[model samples]
Target: MKLYYTPGACSLAVHIALCEAGLPFTLAKVDLATHTLAEAENGSTDFYAVSPRGYVPMLQLDDGSRHTEAASLLQYVADLAPAAALLPPAGTVARLEAVGWLTLVSTELHKVFSPWLWHKETAESTREACKAKVALRFAELDRHLATRDYLAGDRFGVADAYGFAIVNWATILRMPLNPYPALQAYLSRVAARPRVREALVAEGLARD
Candidate 1:
């Protein structure tokens, strides 16, 4: 498969998931600023032609099929490698629980951080309100993480990968993570994973 992504975007979650699943794939870098794919790994730089929706995290399978959306892509990659245990067995409550965490992270966290925090033209008042809401959500995550090593059960899963991608935004957004020590520690633990570290370096987010 070939994954189209923007460095450090939510697509990072899918990238980490792929690595964790031991799936072999290539990456096509999407320059969101230009909506162009850099290095043209997939043969076309016109990201618009690749994805009409024009977002990163578009996974092109070997059979010429494509998958979009971060949460869905995360789950898809996990399902492809059941032995990796990136997700629990299908149709089980545990599986739903992990998937629910992915949805929550996507809606509750990822959506909150984007647009408002990412754009300079966003009104200061709007950014402040966004920050307040995110803090409340962070507190919820902090409480849950206090006694748990991962979002679902005790093993690193898709939700943890998705959560790390979104929650790590706190540092770049200058939002205070100091209030959420458990969440803060959670970030460290996720970052320390071998596969996660590999993804980070591949995307130039960290040193090799």
Candidate 2:
């Protein structure tokens, strides 16, 4: 499998998932600023050729089949290695709970951050609104995480990977994480995982 991704993007969640699953895969760096893939042999390829939406986190399987969307990719990679227990078994309430956390992180946290960070001309009011919404979500997460080590359950799993990816943005966006100590601690715990650390270094987000 080959995963096309932009460094520090939500694609990092999938990358961490792959590593945690102990899967063999190659990384293809996508220059989102140019909407091109930087290939060592081919120079560059139009990213749209992989996905019409021109987004990162496009996973191309060995058979030439492709999967998009960070949440879906997270589940796919986790399901690929059930023994890893990256996610709970499918068709169970526990699995749905994990999906619910992914959805919240993607929709509530990730979407709120994207516009403010990507759009330089975003209205001040809109930026403030986004910050307020993010704070509300963070507060909720903080309350939940105060008792649990992970989002889906007591063990680290796919939902925690997705949450960590989005919440890590708070530091880059200059958003204060001081108010959500539990959430902040959760991010630190996820970052400290050996597989996640490997994924971070592979994406050039970390050293060694």
Clashes of each: 0, 0
> How do the residues 70-170 of candidate 2 rate in per-residue lDDT, one tens digit apiece?
98899899999999998888899998898899899989988999867668799988999999999999999999999999998788888888899889888
Best by TM-score: 1
* Candidate 2: stretches off by over 4 Å: 40-44
Candidate 1's C-alpha runs over 4 A off are 41-44
RMSD of each: 1.4, 1.4
| lDDT values, one for every candidate | 0.92, 0.89
TM-score of 2: 0.95
Q: Any idea what lDDT model 2 has?
A: 0.89
lDDT of 1 by residue, 43-110 (tens): 77788988999998899999988879999899899999999999999999999899999999999889
State the displacement of the C-alpha of residue 181, model 1, in Å, after optimal TM-score superposition. 0.7
Q: What local lDDT does model 1 show for residue 205?
A: 99
